[model samples]
Target: MRHLRSLTRTLHKQRIEGVTFHFDPHHQHELSTAVRHFFTTPEQHTPLDTPEATRGVFLLEGERKWVLKHNRLIHWKKQLQNYLGLKKAFGLHDLTNEFINLSAVSAKSACAPSVAAFGYKGRFPFLKEEYLLVGFLDDHCSVDDRLIAHPEQASTLLPQVFDLFARMLDEGFVHMDPHPKNILIAPDGQLRLIDFECCAHSVIDHDFSLGFLMGYFFHYWIKRFIAMDDYRTCCENYLKVEQPTLDRSIFMPVFERFLTGKVSRTTRYAILTSPKAQAAFKAQ
Candidate 1:
């Protein structure tokens, strides 16, 4: 139960040419070597395939598993945002934001991975790359994989998903990307959320509207791999856990919008036509 607040309070900070490096006091001994190896000889580490370019590499030392997330800071879209001052508004650096969010979320729950260390390699307004080291969770499977493997477990697992969302909401937090791939299902059936790159904190009265839930379901389940019946069951189960009186009518518009979006249109067509997607949706 190493809390982020305590860790940050004891963190060792070093500044070089506007680049700031934060190291966990406990792991300072291994920090330099680990950072060197992470950047110079990445091939020595095991590559992890992530949807985004900020992929991770696993570094094993004795029995410890450290995941080094290499996040590139200079991208065309980010550059445009920087010019528009949007980067400053949202702390647009992905790794920095992820580290901050992870620290905040870890303060609330044990769902987020424990951050070991984080640093930016270059100066602001022209920052190069950023990196974050975190402890890896073993024996965990993505929620998407679990749902596809055991669709029958939806009735049992959907409650856990709802509970996690409820806890996050109660804590005044919201995961901008609520995709199944970002959620890990532990062997003991606990739900652990990962990838805080897009997470945000909100006011206590933040809206958890049916529209938001519908869009979440569409992006995480329906557009990917889920049967119509199971999708309905998920919605119903979520309502059972959150608001029993609210019906599905309020969410239909969100679903309709999801279907009409360009990305959703292409994804829906692909899923409908692909044999693999069809098979996964029909999985039991």
Candidate 2:
């Protein structure tokens, strides 16, 4: 059976070159203990990225560039464990395919290399997933770093980012992680979107086009975070430019029309089941 095969793979920790794989459900605890010891006194220092709600990402480089994602200290073995734990989880759209799939969907979509996934060895408890043999980005700094250094540039860059957002929504994918840090611009000045760990598909009408999505996102981003020096005046201008006498609730019909026509079954199922979506939809 597939479960038996998974178990067998779990028992034997396989390593190819510098990459180590841990998918064992049984030996997770033992493997975690050993890994912690090894990592604590690593032959090469392991750099820690910022902490996230779900996991801690680490930067590793020796033979190659890699981003290692360690457990969040509490959870089931895999990253998808939380999503799978929720009701109608199986019916939810699979974001695991999004990283690779984005390339085909859009030329602007860029992502960090995903070389491997690890869990645990033998019958231990605790899961660790390591990404190995990744290719480096041209300019390694994240958008957050860039913005922190050049706040004035926010006006220019944020617009381009909103464009990216619109395109993804029009294309029927909702990039759940839109933080500035997740986007990277190559040396060639081409934009790339990275980190698909929380990506999901949404219902968007085919006719909606990337432009609509981008414009909306740009406004939303500006409203939520970015505050240009002229922000107060600009916001007043925006209100005047796009004046709407109708109540906000009137937009629900418009949103549903697009969602029902454009979104896939998988996305629809996820939207219906997810608590996040439930609240948003209810409010709408």
Whole-model Cα lDDT of every candidate shown, in order: 0.60, 0.44
Tens digit of per-residue lDDT, candidate 2, span 29-96: 44444445446664454545656664455555543344555443343544334223232233422232
lDDT of 1 by residue, 96-169 (tens): 66777787777777778888887665433444666687877888998888878976676666667767766667
- Poorly placed runs, candidate 2 (over 4 Å): 1-43, 46-48, 51-55, 72-134, 170-172, 202-225, 228-283
- Report backbone clashes per prediction: 0, 17
Cα-based lDDT at residue 77, candidate 1: 62
Tell me each candidate's TM-score.
0.71, 0.53
